[model samples]
Target: MFELIEPIATVSFSKVVTEAFLALGMRNYWDGYFAGRAAPLGLAPAEVVHAVFYNFADGEVARHVPWVWGKTTPEEAIAVRERSSATVLRRGIGVLAEAPGLVRVADLAARAAVSAPTEGRALYAALRTLDVPAEPVARLWHAATLLREHRGDGHNAALLAHGIGGTEAHVLMALTLGMRAEKFDRLHHLPTARLAAVVDGLRDRGFVDAVGGFTDAGRQTRERIDALTDELAAPAYDELSADELDELIAGLELIAAARYKRSDD
Candidate 1:
């Protein structure tokens, strides 16, 4: 059931899809990710990106904004990622794309995505303005991307309400999920001193132990944040009937389970 949206939706940002950005002379990791996500916003400034994106370190946001635009127009970046993501999804989903349920799922997903209010949801609002593809496979992925960014925006709001800073949020995730802190640091360009400071702050607040595992209080806090995020994201699905949601989840699971290697990979 959890695979309904994000698991399929996030393929838009996957490395396989981002590789298309490299053809534009963009770097692989940060450049592709930030540019593809922000391109829909049309030459958005770093401040807007920093404000809307949340969570990532400011340095991480700064690394690509403004400059990526000079290398490639937002429309080109958008087209590249969309085409790339669709190719991966189409190849992976194979016969499932032709299944009768697939079109229904895409329609159901789009209904839910557009039904949600856009106020205070920057990423969702921006992405929603784009033309949805006519093809079912592309439409399904587009619907998923809309819902994913919409939920992510709500998740950010949930974190803000709890007074959780960006670095602190990532810190709690690593501790609670049993992920290595070093791994999180490797993905994000957070400064070593900043990471140490965030950990220190969490320790001071009794959120983590000296060795960085979550204390009971920290675990409870994360549970609360997760619960709030789910609550906030629930509105996006309001247009779907309970039965429709079940069908959507089932349909998405079938698509996500499909296997195919990306040619670029």
Candidate 2:
């Protein structure tokens, strides 16, 4: 029988350097390292490693790696953790306190087939218990109800605008272009009557002023709604075809129209 021998595996200095660079999110350095070693390493074109490096570099994985390693002060980390935990706890408590009162009001409104006085009283009591200021809490509760009824529909945009002191048109344009009303109007061709109607509706709802200014509450509402729309749209945007994006825009227009109709009623 022929003698059989196994070859020992050898690692390249380039490989070590490349790994170190990758750890630092410097993917641009991979090509130079991989160029000559591709065949020996059983890697496809040297470019393959470069592509892999870019993929990791562009992704959150490489961006979030803790390079400072053990450099953070314990006190600083503790403070950050405490702040984050407190915020979460506060939000949880607020949700728990407010949600039951809202449910109770809805239940009473359904069972009594009458005014929401009992529900309002319960909500007031709950807000007091939670140490929430009365007026702001009431507005938030009302906005939450409107959001629940209108989410995923055009009415949600209208309701959000109403909450903020803006018209449905302003909200719709903001959602489409990620900009304010004047900017959106400058970029697109909207009829004056339609624009005026949307502005009027927003003003009536106390979401905006005639001069297209937002009140503090309106600004907060707009920011929240804008954030929600961005979150909802971001994941699906890359997968959507041009036609699909157009369809979505069309749907938004329909929703705007529906909001206008609601205001008319």
Candidate 3:
């Protein structure tokens, strides 16, 4: 049976983490850190709850501040805190107001005897079909659920990459730039044969010409993928409090920063 509490808990915890990061302009760091660590910690209901507070307190402090890398000083960190706090306040208001609707959607899904994937897809389609304002958030939740449910051997990441384009590198780049590398890595840890099959699927689709190469068709495919993701995420923005939005933006920045840092290493 589908557990309504699990999804709600996961979504709420995720939102909290995202909001906390935004307050410090450390969204990317949080996203990347969680992306890498979420599965390793185990995606259990209790684990999800524990992760929120733990990561919010420890992860942000350790990963987000550039001072750890000597890019900023103590005084600069204070200034960032002031600015990020204001942003967080605004985003929090938005997300709190919109959260009830999201919960309602989850409740509806729980009543169905569907699998999480099916429930998520149905929820996503229903959100769009019904013109719900939280459609974008719904889609993101759906994607997250799919990612979480299949977090081994890079299966989820490869599938998402294939859906976007054939080039695993490009997909990795996009996800790392937009999400987190740890998360990307978790989804792509497949054996050699499975990896080859994933690559072959992309080649067949003309989404990629090689492992790291992009075909003209692949570029077009990527464009479509971006469009769809954007379209799906548009509705959820309305529900985010100013704090949540800032956190999400910050998370994106952190992911970008982490990606660059990795490249530098």
Candidate 4:
């Protein structure tokens, strides 16, 4: 019953304000959203492979994310992403079409073209320099991904700044989401003993209970970390006007609603 998100007026000024980060966070949601409709895309090995391909569209193959998941060899993962880039991109945009009011999606894409770029987000910077398709949805997808990567890069920095390593952060997040810790131990390639030590540390810090579930304090702490991450990510949007930000929120909400509705069906 703890409030799941901050009030709209306080933490959210617009939909575009957070869609990339929101979308970036919802890999599971996207996986669930795309779960049933795998016929035409020919996504194989089902669950894990589809997720790997879907995420790869927003990221390049050589990056850490594909390898980090532990579902396949890094080489195979890279090849799958690289080979299926166009297919994944096509399917990703197709999901947007399932939503109502695509005119808003187009508006979001156009306004995004006006935002200034920033430094340190290598993927976003590289994406901005690419010669991608001229189609509006494709452009919007790319633009949103750029913003997602920008926010992602910033999130990594904030995590590092807070002295959180990749494994511990993964464990903490998985636990908070009600997933089995053993699953993450495998997914993150963390040793059992190492994961136990991290869990003990979390328990000592009052982040976990005797049974290893999050304490109330742990949940609050997770919320604080999320809010701090958003604060750290805000600099990427510093140059945009209020009007432009509003359009982004509107557009992303349409897409999210459509996808979530599709998910519920």
- Top-TM-score structure, candidate number: 1
- RMSD in angstroms, candidate 1? 2.5
- Evaluate model 4: give its lDDT: 0.48
The lDDT, on a scale of 0 to 1, for candidate 1 is 0.81
lDDT of 3 by residue, 151-247 (tens): 2112323335445323354343534355432234433444556446555666787855654455678666666654554444333344455665455
Location of the lowest summed lDDT over 10 successive residues in candidate 2: 1-10
TM-score (C-alpha) between model 3 and the true structure: 0.30
* Candidate 1, 128-201: lDDT as tens digits: 88999888888888888898888889889988998897778888777766885657754345667877787888
TM of each candidate vs. truth: 0.92, 0.23, 0.30, 0.56
- Cα lDDT for residue 83, candidate 4: 25
Over 67-144, each residue of candidate 4 has an lDDT whose tens digit, in order, gives 333333333332232223323333433566544455565445534533535465543454455443455544444455
lDDT of 2 at 62: 26
Q: Regarding lDDT, does 3 or 4 come out ahead?
A: 4
- What's the number of clashes in each of the models? 0, 5, 28, 3
Which numbered prediction scores highest in lDDT against the true structure? 1
Sort every candidate by TM-score, greatest first: 1, 4, 3, 2
- The residue-by-residue lDDT of candidate 2 on 1-265, one tens digit each, is 0000000001122244344434434343333233222212222332433332221212222222232212333233322222332333233234433444434432322222121122212222221222211332232232222222122222244334444322353454454454655456432344666556666676677766667666555566666765664443233234445665455345333333443454476
Q: Model 1: residues >4 Å from true position, as ranges?
A: 185-189, 259-265
